[model samples]
Target: MTANAFMSISLDPPLIAISIAEKARMLGKIQASGRFAVSVLASGKDKIAWHFAGKPNPELHGLFDSLDGLPVVRGALATFSAEVRDEILAGDHTIFVGHVRALNWDSNADPLLFFKGKFGALEDTRKAPAGMLQIETELMW
Candidate 1:
């Protein structure tokens, strides 16, 4: 399923979280299989994104590429296969917490992104790849 709500949840153990509507087909599959794969679509792959978002494509009928038995989108800029770590009920969505198992990435490719109400591409204003952004840790009173 196409995720609109997802984020990296941790740094030490490398975790990610995605919230899916409770009744979505993807949720059932995740529950049954105990695993799922995340593919970060490269820029200009909105067509592929829409295909997984429920629009049927006649030619590539169910053309899901796989690595280590996990279904992934071909040509993704980055991909990860993860085992389900936990499931949480978050109002109308079921949050699937995943523990990173296998990973792949291509830093040279720009990411496909959705913003506001439209699909977009990343514009690197910095003009160079920068390392992780640093934020000061908060101190408890």
Candidate 2:
């Protein structure tokens, strides 16, 4: 039931969003709780990513630390404790959006990125392709 659940939302106001199955235990906790921590895993920590993705390990529970009454995993490249801003119903899943309230990080580490069903790290020195252009089209086109 794993999916591309991680995504960066609008940064101006510091917001993030993640999709969770309607039946997931985390859904209830997050919805009722109205908050959650976004821990950006450090490079080479695929196992840690899996644990939060529900890989099933008792020891994984201890990976997080309490900060300002929120839970965050120490050593994460970056951590943000966000308050729920919105919840949108999307078929069998719910999209939870949060506004960043607190944040901490080690600027030297690279962030773990999840794509195509696997986790990888962003290249520290790589820049975006020069002159890349973006095109926007209407949905009905």
Candidate 3:
């Protein structure tokens, strides 16, 4: 549940792929419902990320919100509802190719970033406009 193997596979017709573990409960739900949602958290929602990643932090309690019955991170930068288009087996995960059905975003919001086995926030650099902010401290284990 904490895994994030998702990627944008295409722009034409708005397609995305989420790699879910074969044993992930969410995978079963997606397959059963034929739909899924992606919520891209904004800076300050690291707890939300950790929460969904299967390690709920008590300090982040009550951080979850919803959109049309889909669990969404409160104050996320973006949320997308999609219909499952295809499923492909990949090693120990199943790649769920989704056709984005609806999407919403806040261009002004900085995104929560994950990389290199750590949770971090985007660092505003000369290449990007100023004012990127951190929600939670960079954490690695």
| Candidate 3 deviant stretches above 4 angstroms | 127-141
Question: Which regions of candidate 1 deviate over 4 angstroms?
Answer: 126-141
The model with the greatest lDDT is 1
Q: How well is each residue in 1-141 modelled by candidate 3, as lDDT tens digits?
A: 555676888899899988998888888999999998888888877777787788877776556677656776667798888889999999998999999888889999988888887778877565534677646787899
Number of clashing residue pairs, candidate 3: 1
Model 2 worst lDDT window (10 residues): 1-10
Tell me the tens digit of each residue's lDDT in model 2 across 1-141: 233676779989888888889888888999888998777788887787787667866665567777668877778888888899999999999998988888888988887777777788776576668898657778873
Shift of residue 84 alpha carbon in model 2, Å: 1.0
Quantify how close model 1 is to the true structure by its C-alpha RMSD in Å. 9.7
- TM-scores of the models, in the order given: 0.82, 0.74, 0.80
In candidate 1 the C-alpha lDDT for residue 85 amounts to 96
**Candidate 2 wrong stretches, greater than 4 Å:** 1-3, 58-61, 124-141
Error in Å for residue 40 of model 3: 0.7
Clashes of each: 0, 0, 1
Which 10 residues in a row give candidate 1 its minimum summed lDDT? 124-133
